[model samples]
Target: MLVLGIVLFALGLMFSIAWHELGHFLAARRFGVRVPEFMVGFGPTIFSRQRGETSFGIKAVPLGGYIRMIGMIPPAPGQRIGRSRRSGPFQGLIDDVRADSVKDFRPGDEDRQFWTRKPWQRIVVMFAGPFMNLILAAVLFLIVLVGFGIPTAQPVVQSVSKCVVPASQATTTTDCPPGAPPTPAAQAGFQAGDRIVSFDGRSYDSWEDMQLAIRASSGTVPVVVERPEPNGAARTLTLYPQLIETQLLDLDAARTSGEPRYVSGSFLGLSPIQPVTRQTPEQVAGYVGEMAQRAVTSILALPSKVPALFGAVFLGEQRDVNGPVSVVGVSVLGGEVLASNNAVASEIATMLQLLAAVNVSLFLLNLLPILPLDGGHILPALWEGAKKRIARLRGRPDPGPVDMAKLMPIAYGFAIVIMLYGGLVILADIVNPIKLNL
Candidate 1:
């Protein structure tokens, strides 16, 4: 099962990379830019085929993919292709990049180059890749939320505690201790599988609202519950149980920090049953929004996590559960999920969610305004557009396309850093991988 899960995830990753490149290919073609190659993965070609003007192929490595568009870096202003008069330490690098950008140039293809397209068209071509990832993530999220459903706490009681255990004394055991007072739910004859109907004369639909009402009640309240009979019918029961204030953990504080903060509140001993509940489209949208926010936060915090990743890789340190993960790590997690003893539906849902998260991460990470990234291309296109607009407004000649060759040095440096970070993450993933609780 583990091997199967890993294979499945790897295949999904390849498909995702292909889909992303397809976005760029389609958009580039839409704007009449010449795309010579549409390939998934990096390294030497494993399989390739020429289709019309494009050569489609798979590569040796399955980590990333790309589409080669003509004139990605425009020639120097008023200069011939592959010619540079500038002399500097980075000049050779810039010239090499410029030379490669048009190495496959053919006759009468000047207008078909990517740099010849309007700024908005270039932006569309660049942004289309990441946009495909966003679309795939949303679709996956919808399938998981609407088809399989999400685990939600229902209003039905799963268990009823015999005694009221204060937050301070509640460490592990939930069994009744000596001299502990009986809980309000126990006194009111609450049982497992009973569905809460109303609390204090007001009807309740969700467990959360009923919990808030239970916490706010001061005196004896009319608690109504529908308990199932042995004959398969449910009978309504109303019982008046005096509410007592007790020490309880402050939920907000506990959620913010993994520390217990106790406060006096009305105590109820019922534990709600968790069941899979299908979500509406609005709820799914909200869930996806929250996930996207977390992905952004994770991307922003990547720098701070490098030290921990380094330690985990070289110093034999324990891996942080919430730390960064590489492709290897994600695959291992998928394996673990499948190998677990969870229900089949649960395992499938978890796998879908994991893939969805991967897509979301890809969508956001590629949008960073750094060279070689989709956003890097997008930023230059936007600047070129702005420059053209300003030149027109000032009655001056067009400033022309942004000099992408000059930015190659910075892009090279960023690429090196990315390689190092990716290497560290991959090493850590192999050595000290995060494991699922299941």
Candidate 2:
């Protein structure tokens, strides 16, 4: 099951990457740019087939993918194709970039260049890739939230404990330890499937509210539970719950693999009924919005988290599950989801949600206004458009497109920073994986 999950997840990520490239390929073609190669993954091509002008293929590495558009950067002034220029400290880098931009160039293809397109068209071409990822995320969220639904604990008794056990020592086993006293729920004849209607003669709505009422009580509390009878009638039992000073498990932390923490509180030893509830369209939209906001927050907090990630790996500190995860980490988590003892529906939902979150991350990360990223191209396009507008308003001659080659050095610097950070994250993921409970 773990192997199957990893394979499936890997395949899903490949498709997502391919889908992202397709957006760029189609949009570039739409704007008359010659896209020579549209490939998913980087490094040596594993399998490639030429269709019309473009060669489509997958590479060995599954980390990232791209669509190679012709003439992404404009040529240097008076610099001819296949001609060498005078070398400076950064001249080699500039010449290399320019050469690569027109590498697949053929005669009479000058008019089909990427830089020749309108600024708005260029922006659209660049933005389309990330936009595809966003669409996929929304679709996945819909399938999980509205189609399959989500489970939530309700204010109803699913099971009643036979005996009182320490919260830290509780397990699925029904064997009550020697000398363990019977719980208040068991002594009061509380059974499974009992709907907790009210506590102390007051009707309650949510399970959390009932939990608070139970914890606030000390001695005996008048609890009203509706139990279904064999004769198709419901009987209300007034159970005098002799509350005990027991340790209550922290429900929030119980969802993870960390040792459960216990707090001293009044106990009843009744478990809430968990039911799968379908969300409305509005609710699902809200969920998607919330996820988008969280993605933005995570992206913004990435710089702040670098020190902590380093500390966790080097200083032997606790790993933060909420910290960044690489492709390897995500694939491992996917395998864990399938290997877990959770229900089949739950596993499927979790995997789908994971894929959705990945897509969301891709969408948000690509929007950063740095070179090599889609947003980098977008910023230049917007700036060029603004300059053209301002020139026309002042009745000056057309300034033409902004020279994007000048930003290559800065782009290279940003690329190095990105690679370094990604390396650190990858190392952390391998050395100390963030093991999640769910």
Candidate 3:
């Protein structure tokens, strides 16, 4: 069942990627840019259909898509060296020639050239794919919030959760139910009914925030909180977060339809200070945005020496880095979260929410300044524009287009790194996949 869901969810995510690619495809077509092929997935084609000028196809591997824009980069491998041949045993003798052909070529017609377009136009065309993902995220969030209402459980004190206690009070306490509280987590002092408001500085909304902060802490954390007294008074507090073990529950299914079990974890044993419900679109967005911003700001503050974060790692001390995720990861997350304790309806909503989050993460990561990424390309374009402006001021000719010879090496190197990282992550995920216990 888990594998099935992953497969189906992956297909959905692929279509989402297809939608993103479609955004660029349609825009390019509209702008009269020649699009030779629009493919879903990479490697080899398994299915294809030609529509007007574009050949839309699905490759056997469900990875990512590519737009074969004329003159988008350089020429075909055979064309680069001016060789005329397709792959075959007979062509094996000319493998070197074919390889060099990728470098050759008659600089084709300018009409279909991507570089020929205005910078803004080119920027829009390039950004369209990621833009689609962002839009999809926003729309998904809006739908989840407006149509189904956000699935937020109250932070009310519950007997099932780990104990929440203030650091100062624990010294005088005599309760030792279950095994002694995790010292690391207890020393920092997290108590039930204390009301967790923020994580490492991010507003705490759902368990995701708490778990991320805890794991990021490498088992220790600096916590900020508001304690609501039974007498209607609120006192702000702080604590040292301790390392705690966690057992994840399948969140999606637990939303309702499946048996709900608790996932154990390192906890300050705290709940929201204030018990409030946000069921409206505006309320959900405003609150989720604020919480997400807090997480983002905390990450931004890493260099500023604020409470730093170090999440758990599977192997050694090193953290994992990889090329951007393909759809496979999202499905796995969706499946794992399904193990959570929740009603059926809530489970569905959580699944959607998780998917939105994955989309947002993917959307944002692509914007990092690296070659083959839109932002990376835009960086140089912006620099060239500045240079051109400066040259015009000095009454000199515009600086020539950037030297591809230099850029290609760096870009290809980065691409290789991405490929390698992606392979490793896939391998790690397979060996010890991230799983939740519901």
Greater-lDDT candidate between 1 and 3: 1
Candidate 2 worst ten-residue window by lDDT = 249-258
Instruction: Return the TM-score for candidate 1, rounded to 2 decimals.
Output: 0.83
**What's the residue-level lDDT of 21 in candidate 1?**
88
TM-score of each: 0.83, 0.79, 0.63
lDDT of 1 by residue, 66-97 (tens): 99999899998889897588899999999999
Which of candidates 2 and 3 is the stronger one according to TM-score? 2
Cα RMSD for candidates in order:
4.6, 5.5, 10.8
Error of 1 at 315 (Å): 3.8
Clashing pairs in 1: none
Q: Candidate 3: misplaced stretches above 4 Å?
A: 74-109, 151-155, 160-278, 284-326, 337-342
- Compose the digit string of candidate 2's lDDT tens values, residues 365-400: 998999989999999999999989999999998787
Q: What is the lDDT of candidate 3?
A: 0.57
User: Which candidate gets the maximum lDDT versus the true structure?
Assistant: 1
- Give the alpha-carbon lDDT of every model: 0.86, 0.84, 0.57
Clashes of 1: 0
Residue 391's C-alpha lDDT in candidate 2? 93
What lDDT is reached at residue 176 by model 2? 99
